[model samples]
Target chain A: MSTPTETETPSETETEGGTRLSYETRDRLYHLALYGSAALFSAVILFPIYWMVQNAFTDSQTVITEFSWLPSPETVTLDNFSVLAAGAVPRYVINTIVVTAGTIVVVVGVSLVAGYGMARFRFRYKESFAQFLLLGYMFSPIVLGLPLYLIWSEIGLLNAQIGLVIALSSISMPFAVWLMWKYIQTIPESMEESAWIAGASRWRTFWDVVVPQTKPAIVACALFAFAIAWNDFTFAQILLPSQESTTFAPGIMRLIDQGGYTSWGDIMAVSLLMTVPPLLFAYFLQEYLLKGFEVRTR
Target chain B: MTVHIDNMTRVFDSPNADRIVAVDELSLTIEDGEFLTLVGPSGCGKTTTLRCVAGLDTPTAGTIRVDDRDVTELPPQQRDVALLFQDIALYPHMSVRKNMEYGLKIAGVPEDERREHVAEAAALLQIGDQLDKMPASLSGGQQQRVALGRSLVRDPSVFLFDEPMSDLDAKLKRELRPVVQRITDEIGCPVLYVTHDQEEAMTMSDRIAIMDDGELQQAGSPKEVYSEPINDFVGEFIGQPAMEFFDAHVESANGTAAVSMGDHTVSLPATADELEGYVDSPVRVGVRPQQIGIGDPAEGIEAEHVLDEPLGDETHSIFETEFGDVTVVTHADFDGDGDTEYGLVLDESATQLFDPDSGVRIH
Candidate 1:
């Protein structure tokens, strides 16, 4: 299927005129090139993921001795997963879920109202305020971490899941607000005016009308906030140094840094476990992500 | 239900430009059950005035009173008015039933009563079967009906239509204009419609208020504004083919008034006797195209025929007269050859005389 047949090159005159090649041969070649490149890119991207899964299934003894690309069925074992289920991995997973969920709730709530105000209301220094928000988004978390830690410690929130949640929300808030403001601006002002003329108060209009209309953007913002808080290692490591309070990302790093080469399978198994929730969440919410990009009125 | 706008003004200040006075000291009264239309060219402050009435745009000064209650300081939700936007601003996410019932729900009407009101309004609009459908699924005309239904269910004290029919096709617009009129009539509420289309203003409004540069030009019935315009702008802004103006000198001799232009002089009617004091002064004579009559070549002022535009029922003959270019709308059966000369007579009763400098009507 990769090589062109003899009949495929029968269109020299058509090619010279800049017209299309013969239908059957052209279709075959075009599809072959498109699908071949697609498969190649998929393999390139998915190979690391496949390797992680293979390492997670292999026994610790086999992983230490063999360097084969494929895992043999006889050597595949559930010992690494059993160790993870029985260890602190469960507690770390719960901590990650709590921090990520809290971060998403706070980020989505505050940013939605702030974004709506920025997009709809006319205020003094509006442009300057928006620029200030963009600056917050542009600044790296590393730059803001020391001050945040000091403030959390002063407030007696250090080493607490709520403290981690608040820190993650602050990092994700500006991006969430920027996304929401851009989305809400696409809604015509007439829709709000219509609600107003329908006898709805401002609060009712915001909740009943603007909220429902911006559902897709809200879902996308939630997913983004989730990803930010779920994958954060730096903030969790700095703010939560206690062994029992840390999230999965820093916990996995701590396990890998224990200086033992025979525990590779356990590390791979935990990493694979950490990737599952986000993949499932994104897969289920792919529809809303697509809809978020469509900002037309009707 | 009377809407009294007292010396209302709206000024908008842009970041990059000076303040724009959108509605300047505009005052009007819409009586109960009367349909008044604000008509003008684009950027003429008609929509601004309508928005002010709807409480969508706040006025810089003055007060708006509906049924003797001053609502200028109130928000749109507090004012008992329904505004049908130009885009037919239906809540796209809601079903038709939900859209119509929203206002009632917000007003704290009982559920059963809300359902009844929605049903009644939907039936009135003939959209009962489409209640469950979303606005995106409906056609343009259907969407317009749904918008009207939403407003109708509110039973507002006033209805503000912001060119709601402008988005529909010509046939649909024609079909829906009377439906709008009938609904407003049934509701017996004052309606203030805004549109830049003169024809819609003339056909749909009980009284038309013409505006230009954020100032009211004139407010009168369509016939009064068309036949006896207060100024040159009103004269030119109304009617098809437009009114034509000729720069002429007013001459009063032998106890009679006449206007002289170039080599021709046409006698003015007795109603123009007010111009006697201004005899021999330059004045602008206005005449509608339909008011000009073609006569025998030997009888009246001579004009050379330039072209003929044959409409279905009448043919408008463009002639090169001493008045520059004049259009005469004659019956369809009337025949005249292009390039030939003919005599023209102005309908003395329809002739409008204006001060040449100020463009204000003399009588």
Candidate 2:
């Protein structure tokens, strides 16, 4: 809502000295550059999702024959969404929900406590242990999946939904704990000490004071764990081979393999559906998630 | 209600450095209803001593007793002491009322009783209307009142304030000082307040315990410490403009004693008997700014005027003398732009002598 001011006349200001700019002019130019890059980056990132939505609503014949920026309304139909009502797609979604919920519960609870201890307490090898957590997080999931498959097969945990849940949690938990630890560090320690002096035991103080202050971090950690478990393909593919335990990420591929044919419309529809929960999570909880990442000092 | 800190010591050790003795072997006692301000410079261990009494920091060697019971090893909750932090540590998520009720709730006080305690404390602190508001919704002073109300509800046997008003502005500090004093007086508990401001110690405390370098320098009433300081550190630390000192030599001959500085000398009074030991030896002569006066140019010790600081009711005039710079406080106005030379009249009877080597009072 800014009107054009004297600084908006770049030529007049630049005439004084070609390299020297007025403060307002310089600030406007910087913002224009920043927003230009952001728009370009967002377009690049969002194009695939936009194309998937476009193709999902179009008939498979038209989608295959035409390359268009916008879908024609005449070809749009609800027939592509029939995958949601039938086949392994529904079962895959149910399995994903159970695994995602379990991962969230395990990750949020454990990381909350571990993060509190890491931020507040001092013990032997504390720094080393913290570094070790980051080190564990750096390994690719494929590196863990192969070794973990051998162990799961030995224990008969293979092809179980619980095995997938456990695998996903281990993959996501280290970074979640690191996020929580850094977030909790921003909270003042005196807030906890005040509770301790108020006759609350250490556990009671942690619950009454620290937990309430960490709500944003809790939400953010839950979302993080959910995204990891929901979108995970490697661990789910390796551990849960049965269709009953297979989640959407790898289960949708089974359709192409079933009859030596690819239903591009059905595939696009399923891919769009797969992106919903995470998109909803990002849209609804973006405030708390942003706050969780902000390292505000008090 | 009395708190006894006996030979308490706290030592911190780390791998990269030598051990830090935060609080040396120090002993002190706070009688019931006494408002004792632990006043000192930074890194002087005043806060450490207060923390030990509150059971926040464990003393490495000595025992602390509260109300005739040894509470040295007890945690802060079991010690029955309420501490007001300088940071005003209020629970940000809770309303003022909930903040006050937290201690009682943890102690298993029933809902009705907890509400009553919270209500009473809220009314007492004039924060009754703010009970339902979050701490962030209130002003800084109001937030601090909520913090005070939180401690007031507990009614602990000992009250500890760690520079509570240090964050407030000058006007706010002056307003809150009497409020804190009146509340502590009504509670009749041993209150140990810590601050580095000497003026705060003088105005608010019934007695002051001055500390330096992890050791107790002196502990007495403000009047007593200001007038009869045991050492040069206390003399220099207690006053606003600070007491000035000059190098002088004691000259004792035939039952009379006098101290000479540069070319001027002042005869000692009946207390000259103490100067016999310091005869023909160097000493530090300490005098308050108020004790010296601007004299005639040819009468007293010759000096050159440096600057004049007008402090409302009085002016502090700094002058360069043969020994060093001396400050003379007077009620008369002096122009800083004029008058570069003057003589300083030393008040003979008011001057105190100290050993130059140890900075300890000689008489």
Candidate 3:
């Protein structure tokens, strides 16, 4: 209940009368240690990203050398990217973009209406429906892979873009619901009520007042979905493996498989290629991204 | 311009479809251009009544008429009303121009008129420069003006203000009140302002309608309500220092009418001739803090000073008198103790008396 003396009036209490030399030494030591560890940790975290780009330019000749962290003159080249691009891989990038875009549309659009319903309206099984949607998040997707493959195969949706869309979207919906619910809760109920009284229809209030205020959250939700759908390898590998339907993830894995493990340049290049879409989306939406996480309260 | 509500009621039925009446079967008429405030404590149905009139929520059983036309089943837009909410719900993503432009667009105003109106409201509110800025970029007061501008573009006939100034600091509230007064005056429409803060109601409304426990307790002009409250609730709800209430009895001291408390007699003005026969009945006396001046300790009825609040201009001194602990506002300051001997003299014109049991104010 009581604030500490140091926090109450720090200048007066930080060091009564004078700073101890030993304490200053300890403090400087702590600062050095913190920045040092942070720098080391940042390098460790970004190493894979750095290695991906590094490996992309390096050819198969030197990738398996003890030089994972460096580029060797004998093995560094653009041949892997050229080889990948020469085939149907570029087409697969288009397919991946199509599938991810499709998934984002369904995920964002459905979650928005569903989130608003679960947040503001009254209906039968409202709570239970929300729970039912959330139930999709309970288990690992690997467990359902077999059944999903069989279902899609039986439905004749296997090896199609729509199959990838449905697969990735179903995986992303529960998360979308949960985040959207939390985001919508932050907008005070009075805000929508005000719109109601301000002569906006129920639907108008959603579009005019609620949706505008929620843009930051919605964009952040899109970013989350984009990340999930883009990086997804399992469903794309399992559901769409036909010649024309292969996505970026499955295409990259197949390239690495055929080109042997030493083609570090190809592997790393594809990894870095996948990172650019999210990195670009996040870079452009940096402001909303910050705002989305900032909890709003009335 | 006129508002008529008959048998209005709203029941909250979620937890148990067993109804909890927020606004009970209430009915009233508001004259054209009347700045009537629905004032009460929280959960007192004041806001609910305003919401019903605004068509934000449908009443369980009732009809609402605005300007002689039924709007009970109509939604807010169809009812021709605009509400300035407590949160000032301006869209954060849009510039102030777009924010105000939305209502006009919805109302089917032409682009030229919408632009002209947005500019006019912005300039009228002195927020012309903020038109290009998003709502998040403006200060709270400016954002509120944008909300007002949005409503102004709609040009609705009825203005509903739901505690619009409740979120601002005291200083900003004081600054914004006169601006609101100017805008409402220029528009001259029927206005329903809802607030639990009686000070705002007293300052902003032409008539203050006091709501309590899902019922209308009393309604009158601010001055009339202050001078002649219908009950203890109205008296207590209105006034700055609030009316001091005391449980006493009407008595005739040998042919002279007076109220006696523990050997002390308040010889009320003889104009109160109606209480001539009500001699032995217990009564409640209400007096405003402003009406009583603390005189010389030896000249008037004695009391003790309990506490004093200096509100810059006038000092509110609470004194424990024989009748009750009374509030007195004065410019002078003095240190006093328990039974420190303070005299009291009432401006009988401003004091009210009520029935002790029923709390009905008696003239």
- What is the RMSD of candidate 3? 5.0
TM-score of the second chain in each model?
0.92, 0.94, 0.92
lDDT by residue (tens digit), candidate 3, A85-157: 7677787788889998999998888888878877877788877887888788777767767789999999999
True contacts kept of 3: 0.59
Best by TM-score: 2
Write candidate 1's Cα lDDT for A191-264 as tens digits: 99999988888888999888888888888889999999999988998898888999998998888787655488
Please list the residue runs of candidate 1 whose C-alpha ends up more than 4 Å from where it truly belongs after superposition.
A1-40, A259-262, A291-297, B253-256, B293-311, B315-345
Per-residue accuracy of model 2 over B296-355 as CA lDDT, tens digit each: 757678888888888888998888888788788977566543455577888878888888
Order candidates by DockQ, high to low.
1, 2, 3
Ranking by TM-score: 2, 1, 3
lDDT of 3 by residue, B26-85 (tens): 887778778888899999988888888888788899889987798988877677788898
How would you encode candidate 2's per-residue C-alpha lDDT over A1-298 as one tens digit per residue? Answer: 2446543566766787787777686778999999999999999999999999999999988887888898888999988999887888899989999999999999999999999999988899998898887786777888999999999999989988888888888777788888889888978877877788888888999899988888888898898898899999999989988988898888887876778768888989998998988989988898765664452322
Q: Any idea how many clashes model 1 has?
A: 0
Can you list each candidate's DockQ? 0.68, 0.65, 0.44
**Cα-based TM-score, every candidate:** 0.91, 0.92, 0.88
Positional deviation of B168 in candidate 1, in angstroms?
A: 1.9
